[model samples]
Target: MYSNTSELAEDKLLLLYLLDKIKLPISNNKVTEIILENNFINYFTLQQYLTELANANFINYIEQEGKHRIIVSNKGLKVLSLFRNRISEVKIKAIDCYLKKQMESIKKEIAISADYTIEGNNYIVNLKAVENNSILIDLKLNVASNKQAKDLCAKWKKNSSKLYNELFKVLINN
Candidate 1:
């Protein structure tokens, strides 16, 4: 219930993910396998985090099949959206705004619906520590070999020609 703990945020994410995986209140084997596959944490370390999670009341259960059979408490799922928004490497809203302007020239895809998230490189911009810079720019832009990304950048930069040339130059060179 307490969200103030440092581990609570990450623990909350794990709880939600695990709960989704074992929707039927599974035993330890199934839960542990899912956690390992997702790379939430290594086996040894997860044990420690699990204790913290129990203390935080995100998830609590007995160990079965040599692993923890976890479930997401209501208090746990409550923090998921907050953690997702806070820890996300890319801010979805900013990317949507930037991509909306840049990709206008390209074929539209669903017009930025609510589910749009920074799940992949195509729609993602590593926004961690990204401050005091143009909205659309990111290090991942360097890996874009496709015309869509290039053209989108060009269109955006072209639109802002008088205000700044740095963005336009990047698009032009690409």
Candidate 2:
């Protein structure tokens, strides 16, 4: 939606600013959701900006499990510090407000995950707990039925922390 060169630069700076503010590796989907939800930029434009930023080393992509997560680089932080004011104050405040409201949900989304796939005659369930871009636990199990796999995945998402604690306790105490 931006038609001017300055506007283009501003948009790119905005993206960098947002990524720097997040301070955590975030999924592409969540980044898209945040930018689109705020009507900051169009989807295609956002994608283009992201690619440019990555290409310029302003952002870095990490492949965790099967998902690509984005984080701001040190170079990006320096750039943001130098040109952050290119983004309007209104937009900056808006981004901060949105993050304040959504941070908890965002952290939750990044912390625990579960998925299942069929393999031969059984189902393979993968459960994980992640913190600060590190894997706290990666547990895989084989279940006999689709229903069981689904149930386990759902439970893992909801109770991974408790389950992990109990598992650690048992393993260490035994």
Top candidate by TM-score: 2
Predicted candidate 2 versus true structure: per-residue lDDT over 47-96, tens digit per residue: 98899999999999998767899999999889889988889999999999
Q: What C-alpha lDDT do the candidate models reach, one value each?
A: 0.46, 0.90
The sequence of per-residue lDDT tens digits that candidate 1 reaches over residues 17-55 is 545433434445544554575555567666666677768
- What TM-score quantifies how close candidate 2 is to the native fold? 0.87
Off by over 4 Å in 2: 1-3, 162-174
Q: Give the true-structure RMSD of model 2.
A: 2.2
**Model 1: residues >4 Å from true position, as ranges?**
1-8, 62-68, 86-174
Q: Which number leads on lDDT?
A: 2
lDDT of 1 at 129: 13
